[model samples]
Every structure is written in structure tokens, then in C-alpha cells.
Target: MDSSEQQDNLTESSGCAQAALFGPFQLIMKDGAEVLISNRRARAMLAMLCLAPDEPIDRDHLSRLLWPGRFEAQAKASLRQCLSDLGKLLAAADCDLLDISRSRIGLKAGAVRTDLSDLHDLLTEGKYLEATERLVSIGAIPLLDQMNYGEAFDDWLSVHRQQAEQRLQSAVSVALSALEKGDNLSEYARLSSLWSVRHPPAQTIADRKQGKVRIAVLPFKSIADPADHGFFADGVVDELITSLGQVPQLLVAGRTSSFQFKDSDKPPSKIADTLNVSHLLEGTIYRQGEQVRVAVSLVDAESGFESWAYCYDGSLDDMFAARAEVVQAITNGLSDALKLTEHASQPRKLTSDRKAYGLYLQGRALTIRAIGDGVLPTAIELLEKALEIDPEFAECWTALAEAEINMTVFTPCLDRLERCEKAAGYAKKALCLSPQQAHARIVLAFYAWTQNDIIGALDLAFEAYRLEPNNPDVLNRVGSFLLYCGRSRDALPYIEASIDQDPVNGRNYAILSGVHLNLGNIEAAVEAGQRMVDLGFPSLWLAAALAVSGDREAAIETYQLTKKLMNTVIYPPAGSAPLNPDAMDAYWLMAAKGLWSGKDQDRKNYCMVLEMLHATLHDPCDSTIVLPAIWMGEAPMVFKTLGTQITTANFFAFMSLWTNAEPINRVRLHPDFMDFVERIGMVAAWEKYGWPDLLPKPSTII
Candidate 1:
């Protein structure tokens, strides 16, 4: 029968019967009374039918699954008894929810409303909003959490559960597309946050090719008095992972993913299963003053057995040699254990001076942390000291450059432009010494973008990607630069690839969100934004996305949260404060008020605050007024603000403004819009690449 006919039959026969397949299995009848089926096999049969509504399962197959080890006749009898008992319970509840035939049985189409069935219907109907809402309410609870039959049924259940998860993910994607098309920002944000909470970005064994050997290097335990040498052990592991990652044949788990299991009491097999690796490498470090002892072991994740083991002893005076010995031994051990042909290349020493190398490690670790007061400044000091000790330490220069660039964001009181310039100098020095420094190239790319050299930025970014194709940071930088140049379609693959490699990095998600947002994929944008928030990254971009998506309340709340985080958790160094604290406070206050009110006058008030802050800070390219002016429907103010930024050769803020959102379209529809694009060099970039997803070619811009 057609769907409508089935619906009519269901309405007449199944009175108020609903099946809850997600979480604990429940069959609720009329008046919210749940029908209790004490038979596990009966419940499993019902679940199978519910999952495949309207699809018949063979009686033989069902019997085998329900009674795996029993004789065929016995299993058939058991299945018949279970079916009879289930039918009687349904009859008592006044529900005709089953479709039984001579040789097959199934749940009748539309016989009983189920969360899974409803989700499928909504998704099929292209009603992404409702589908997303349903998913949000369902809240990550797996299908039939309490029901497990025999081995056959359990295996069948596992496959079906995986299918359910895939369907839910598909619903999320489709809903994001629908929401993007409808421009429903509020629901988009809500749904995206739910998606983030439900599905964090992490790679599984499925991400690797079949038969590929994957491994995770767990953190080395430090067996030292006071445990003060833990950082040293961590640094050793970091270098070890980097060295192993260079072996093209090995699929190494990312440091972020591996470090998550630090001090975990879980067994090697379980940890390996979680990390989706076939093998694991774990070790220990013992330090007494300058003297150290290191022991390492490689374990087969399946059996949790030690495949190989090694030990090394060295003093801090010969740390580099010791680290090289340890790395070589591990690589050789892995090669023998896994029967690999390819070997890891020789380790590249950052510096010959042990003190300088140790200092560099400490500084690099702090730079990677990149948060808390005085952290970045302390890193910079240590890096500088390392450089002083070894003037030709190219890696130290890169570390310093990274630390400097981070200062612009984490230590907001520092002069941003000055930091960029310093970063540029350090990056160039590093590049001069070692031309293949992808990190240095990435730093230079950002510096070039800040200096309004879009083409130069793109070139540097692409060059870095070429140098380090599998490097997540390089991939993210390339994607981010492409995004800034209004190339969201081109940026997506790189962003996705980066996420695949380094799923936990919040900055990756931030860029991913921006790419989706500019492409008008509101659901995906919000999803990435939520992930960014979860990763403890700045939520300002997410707030902006919510604002544009028409979620004013969420936008304001996110903005306020971001402001609070900046003031409290991400404060500047002790000696430095904002040059104009009152203006800064007023700036945040007015922005929040405008976002909350969403009124023209309130937005205009925010524009005034931006102007005041601009004047107070002496920044001619005050891009802060553009969004407020757009919100105020003051196209002239938008043009004026953008024109000032263009005149001053600051194209950094223009990246986010090039969109077809209603607020942004107001700026685009202005008579001078084409002239503005021409002046900003976007016309050239678009011509060379392709037009933005939402915009017309310059020739078509009437």
C-alpha cells in the first residue's frame, strides 16, 4: 500500500502505540502504559522489525539469530513461541503493530510511531529542521541499549546500530543544508551545538586503508623524584612521534590523541582500540639530576603483548645523542615487529648545544600550550635564550616566530601589527636557514595576509602545504588562507583533511566553520563553531556566525562568553594592559547591547563606539564598524569603513564580509560595491581562481 494508505491503516489499527528504539527499548501503548516483554528474544525480534519497518525478515533467519546454537526445529519452535507471546501482549494492549505472513514477519508500515521511523520520515521528506530537532531530543543514546540476544543477534545488532549512527549523521548534514538554504540561524546554532556534543571529530580504524599498520605512541611515564622531569619525557615523546610520522609507511596517531591517554589506567588493548591503532608504543623515563634512564616497549594492541622492548642510558650533557639512540631503537624495533620495509629517516637535530636544545623544547611546549597569563611571553624568552646560545638554530627561530604570532591573539595588549612584523622577521630567518620549514612558511603566510598581500599569502600557504602535505597545521593554514581569500569551495578539502589528521584542534574547526558559513552551510557552520567552543578556542567567530544566522540571543550570549574568556582566562601579561581599557569595555558593552537589541538605533550606537575605539586606538582601518553598520542598514557607513580599510591596505577584515547574507548583500548591492571589490584586489583573485559561491563575476556585477 501507498504511504497514506498505510498511515490510514495504522491510525485505525494501532491506537496510540509508540515504540522507543533509542536508549532503553520501550513499547508504550494507549494512555502511556508500557508493555512489558520479559522475553529477550521477543524484544530483539521487535527491535529488528522496528529498525526495518515494512521490510520482512525470513523466519529461518530470524530463528537462527534468536536461537544461535539450537537445532533448526527447536529454534523454529522457540521463534514461534516468542512470536505468539509478543502478539498476545500487543493484543492485550489493543495494538496491531506487526505484519506476519506465512514465511516472513515484519513491523507493519506506520503501524507504530517510533523515534527511528520518525527520523527517517523527516529526513526523507527533506524536513531537516524537524529531523535535527528530533536528533537533538534523542541526544546520543544508542539504539536498544539494554537488549542483547545470542551471538548471532548481537552481531546483527552491532551492524544495525552502526547503520543508525550513519543515518543520524546524514540527517545532521541534510539538516544543515536545509537550514543554510532557509537562513534559519537560531535553529542552526542549536542543532549544530547538539551535533558537536553528539559527534566529536576523531578518526577511527575505518579512516585507514585495509591492512595498514596504525600505531599510537602513548606518553612516557617519568620515574623521577618530584616528577619535575615529566616535561622532559613529554618532549622526548613529541620528538619520537614526529620522527616516526616521517616514515611514510606508518600511520601514527596524532600527539593530541595519543597524549589524551596519559596516566590512563586502561589496558594496552583497550587504549589501542580507542585510538584505532593496531599497535602501541609506551615507555618510561627515569631522571636523577642530569643523568637519565629510558625504557621503551612496543605492544600488539590485539593481544596486549610486548612485541619488542629496549632501554637506553644517557646524561643531559649528551641528550641529543641519547634521544637519537632511543628513536633509532624504536624505529628498528617497529620495523622488525611489523615486518616493514621502509625505515624512518635519520633524526634532524634542532641544535648541537644541549642547553639550547633543552630550552627550545621547553619553549616549544609552552608555545603549543598557547594559553594562560605569561605563558607565551615566557616561551618567547626561553626561545630567545636558545637562539642566543645557538645563533643558527632554525627550529628555535620557528618556535620563537610561532610564540610571537600567538602573542597577538592570547596577549591582546601587545601591538598586533608589531607582533606580526616580528613574527615575519623570525620566520624569514628560519626559512633562510632551513628552506623546508613549513611552520615558518605558515607564519609568513599569516604575516603576508595581514600586510594585504593576498597573492603572496596564498603562495606561501600553498608552498607550506606542498612541503608538508600531511601536516595538519600546514593543511589548516592553507585552508584558512584560501577561506580568507573568499575561496571556501577550494578550502574545504584541505580543512577536512586537516580535521582528519588533527581532529581535536579547535583552530581547525574555527576555520572549518568559517568556510561552511561563507558557503551558506549554516548547519555545518554551527557544528564547527560548537566544536571550536568545546576545544576551548575563541568563540568570537562563532558568535559572528550566530549573528548572521539570525540567532541574536545566542550571538549575544556567545559574544559575552568570549569577552569573559578573554578577560579572565586569556589575560595579557602582568605588566601590560590595554592602552584604552575603558574604550575596550565600552566596545564590548555596545557590541553586546546592539546584538541583543538588534535595533537600528542600538546598532548605530555600536557604530559610534567602534568609531570612538578607532579614534582612541589610532587605527585607521577600523573594520569593527562594518558589521554594526550592516546591521544598522547603513550601506554608506559600510562602504566608508571598508573604503578606509582598503585605502590603508588592510584586507584582513574583508575575508568575512564577502558573502550573500542579507546583511552583507546590503553592502554588495551598494552602487560602489564593484569599485570596492576592484580596489581590494578580490576581482583579480576571483578571476584567477573562481568566483565566490554566492557572488557573480565582476563582468556580471551590474
Candidate 2:
């Protein structure tokens, strides 16, 4: 058991677990019921350094082993950050995990349990060969043994995949071994199969049902002779939907959600099945002069029981009142018969500007159905006219903001940021007037994000979600921000949640695409990217993901196709927020100062675009987002240039990425970058806007 003999035995051994003597440490459970476990690397690092006990591990060898594919200086800096984070996490647990100095890190012997020691103890217990085999089978040793090179990140990705596969293999082996050694395997297998059925087997998210309610507001047949007042029948259907929604204990189907079944040859049972409703409400409306008659009957979906029937007549002016009466009667019937809870509707004074509201609703109606030839333009014109008549209207402003935001997708702009800013302004105004407005808040956040103010956008998005927890747009923005933050794994759950809330929304499809890209999940990114493209938005960002996820050829092709589509199909002239390569003065400054690690042609084209963008950078404000920082070397280089000369005050201001200063971060930069120090000076900026985890600090110069 001498030290030298022990070390030799550990090194020569292979398979699962190997043991070497290490120090004793304490373990404490936190008040929050959370476990505080030492990271494998931290424990290993400590033990290695502790080999010389309380002395620093040689920085060079440490960096080489700990952070492969990273610059030595950069790796050293990250080790500092990792230690800092671990210190904070442990300090909260009242554990002093490390004491660090110029080049050393050491753990207090009593601070925490060393899992490495535990694994060793377990391996040394009786079945040494079996334990070693298990550790090797699990692949931790391979990960521990790796000493990666900077020029081979793709190889790192391979290592990551191999590590994952090895983990699965190890897990299966352990499970099988336990099965062989223990009993009652039948229950575990059955439970595992049952649990698996509760969720989708792939990346596709399955929608879960929330609160359920059963009631139907029967569709009313038109009594206005079918020839003249065709619009009146629609109005009656609309009024009923509005009135029924006032009841909280109801999932009343909207006219749009219901009318699809109209005139279809489908039977009532089939219609009910399609709507996913538990009851059917069918009725008719007839108008004779100033008076109108409406009839409705509720049919149970499951038992086929007749729930109730109702009829109403009222003068034209009291038409709305009559509709309200029908809603009240249905709720009263349900309460009296089924003993269900009744929700009271909150009363509000009708808006004073009824004429303007009418026009606005008309515009909204067009906008909601604003699909097909001439529909979008017609909706925009109507909304514009409504705004013209009542320029200060909050809802109208929000709607206008949405239309304009959508407009940028298909139309070219002199500057996308400028147009996006204008949309943001409108949304902000809408929020100012009605702070509880969900749609406006969602749009404002989206605007902030596109403009690269990620923290601001996320705050607004979360605020919007709080205002209307079920708001699909808010969830979509949250999902998008998660991806932007490089929490793609986290983003998937959020985006998937949005789809569950509003599966039919084309916008959610877009957010899902970005989440996939964030995970470096290339095929999934492509699938979701195609969905977004088919749903009619540019996939420039998606193309970038495709490029990095080892699909450079497809990415190049996607770029060519998207460019052609923007020119020929989407816009004929001034085809996009065109970046004119001819306009840049210092284009080669970027190319000459630094180089893109991408394909040479990509480098060439990107350098050309950077030239155009750089000329605009001289302006006090530039429309170019920091997206250039992501895709190529242009932005960081310019930021480097600005850092060298920009005034101290301006430099400080530019450091706040959350406060309308950070450039859009589209590319997740590689860590071996020269700008890490400057990027550190502007850390707040990148954290609030750039890829959060991948915030590669500018490298330290020797």
C-alpha cells in the first residue's frame, strides 16, 4: 500500500473503477433539500495538486488536461471562473471547497466528500477487476485522460458523443448486473415501460391537456333569409363566443374554432370529435326588420343527452343584450342541472370611442383572417385607417406593431434594425398605455431581442407571461431568448411548452427551430428550420447553425437558395436589408487583421459584408447588429478598434449589452479568440446578449 505501488496499480488498471489513496472530507446537506456534490474534475484536480499537498498544480499541465482545445492562457482564466463559481455554490452550502493563490488551489480536508475516494473504496472492496471494468465501461477514464488540442474542436465534439454513448452502455450494464444479482425485476421493467409511454420517444414534444371543461354554445342558423344579411349570421355567432368566454369555468370554442364544421357533411358526433369538446351547441338566428330571433340547443358529446334549449328575440339595438342573455341561460342551466361552478363576468364601461373600436375590430378581423392574395395588404390598410381615425389607441398601436414586425420578414429594408426599432417603439407605446397588455409586451421583448438587448427582451417577455400566463407569444419569446442565451437544452422545454399552449401557431415553429440549433442538433435544426421557412420567414440564423453542426456544404447551399429566394420570390429589387460589399471602406481591415476559420468562400463573402457594415459603424449609431460578431470576425474586430480609441464614457456605455448596447450575437464564437479580455471588459454586454455559456472572453496576450 505504499504510494508508488498504489499509483502504479491505478494506472495499469482498466475497465470501470480504479482507486488511489486520497484525503478525508465532510459532506453536508443543504437546508433547501439540495445535495452538494463535488464536481469530478474539481475533486480530481484537488487530489492531483494535493499529491504535493496544498501546492499548486503546474499551470501548464493543468490547462493541457483540464480544458483541451483551448489556449493555455484562456484555459487558465476559465479554471479561475470555474473555481469562482464552485466556491460560490459551496459557500451557500457553508463548505469551503478551495483556497486559491497565484497558481495553486487546495481544498480544506473537512470541506466535502471526495467521490473519487468513494469510488476507490467501492472498487477496492472485493471485486477490483469488476469495478475497474465498470469505470472503463462507463468512459470516465477516457474523459479524464483526454488532452485535447485547440485546432481540433470537431474532435472534441466526437469525444462528447463517445462519452455519451459510453455512459449509456455503462448504465445498461449496471442495470443488467443488478437484475442478475437482485430480484423483483418484473416491477422495474413494467414501471419503466409505463413511464416511457407518458412521454414522446423523440424530440417531438407531445401536448398535455390542461384544465378541462364541458359545455357547448350551439351554433345558430341564420334567420335573415340567407340572401341579404349573411354578415348578420356571422355576427350572431361571434357575439355568442364573446359572451360565453366570460364564464371562467368554460372552454368555449371560438366561432373560428367551431365554424370549420359548418356545412361540412360531418355528423354532429364527428364534429364534436374534431373539436375535442364534450358538448355540442347548435342553434339558428333569424332577423326580421328591427327584431332578431335566435335558438340554441346543447347536446352532450359522450352520452348523447340533450342538455338544454333556448330562444331569444330582441330589437337590433338590443342584439348584444340578447346574446349575453343566451350565455347567462346556458351557464344557469349547467349550474342548476350539473351542479358545476358558475363564473361571474366582470363588468366594464364600454370604450367611449366606439366608432374607432368598431373600425379597429374590423381591421383585426381582417388581420386574423389576413391570409391569401391581397388579404395582408387589405388588413394593413384597414388597420392604418383605424389608426388614422384614432391615432392614440393602444390596441391599434399593438396590432400595427405586429403587422410591421411581420412585414420585415417578407420585405427588404434599408436597415432591419431601424424597421424593427420602429415596431418596438409602437409596442412600447402600447405597453405604456396598458401595462397589462400581453401582446404588446411580447412584441416589445421580441423587438429588444432582434435589436440584441437580450436581458431587456427576456424581462419584458417574462413580464408579458406573468400578465397572461397562457400567452403563446410570451412563451415563444422566452424560448427564443433561451436559445440566444445558449441554453438550447433549456430552450427546448420552453418552446415545446409554447407548442402545447398553441400548437397551430406558425410562430412557435420558428422558436423550436432555434432551440434545436442551440443544442447543435443539426438534423432537428434542419427539420424545424424547414418548418419556419415553409411558414414563411428567412432562415439565415438556421443556415448558420447548419454550418457549425458539420453541415457546411448544406449550409452553403441553404445560403444560396435563401439569397435567391429573397431576390426572386420574396422581393425583386433591394431584395433584403442588403449589405452592399461595395459600400465598406475598411472591409479588408477585418480580413487583414484577423481571419475566419470557415470555408474560404464564406470567409471572402463575409469579409465583403463586413466592409459595408464597418462604414456604417463610424456613425454615432449603426443599424448593423452585432450579428456580424457571431457569423464572422467583423464585429469583435471593430469593437477592438473602438476599444482602442472610443471615449472612456462611450466605452463604459457600450459595455452594457443588456442596456441597448451589445451587438446581436448570432455566432457562438470559439474560445481561442484574441478578444477575450475586451469581451471580459464587456462581459455584462455579452451575458445579457451574446451566447451566455459560450461567452468566450478575449484571450490574454503574453
lDDT of 1 by residue, 309-411 (tens): 8888878666656677668777877777788876656465477787787788889888988877789999999999999999999989999999998876555
User: For candidate 2, what is the lDDT?
Assistant: 0.49
Best by TM-score: 1
Instruction: Using lDDT, give the best candidate's number.
Output: 1
Model 2 RMSD in Å is 16.7
TM-score of each: 0.62, 0.51
Q: Model 1, which residues run further than 4 Å from truth?
A: 1-214, 225-228, 256-280, 299-308, 343-346, 545-550, 564-567, 570-590, 618-655, 700-702
- The stretch of ten residues in a row with the least summed lDDT in candidate 1 is 197-206
Candidate 1: RMSD to truth = 18.7
Q: Per-residue lDDT of 1-702 in model 2, one digit per residue for the tens?
A: 123433344443432222221112113232213323356444445444323333445555665666777787898887777676666776775645565767556654434332343333443343434443433222111222222234343353345434433443444445545644666465334322222221111121222224446444444566675443344555455555554545545555444446555556666776677566777877777778767777767778887777777777788657654445555675566555555577665322122354565555566566555344465456667677877777778877887777666554433333445656777888877777666566787667656544445455555655554444433455566556555444454457657655553443554665676556545565786787776567455565456556656565666566545544343333311222423534322332333222223555646666565555555544322223233433453445545434343321122122212111111232223243325423433334332233233333222011
Residue pairs with clashing backbones, model 1: 185-549
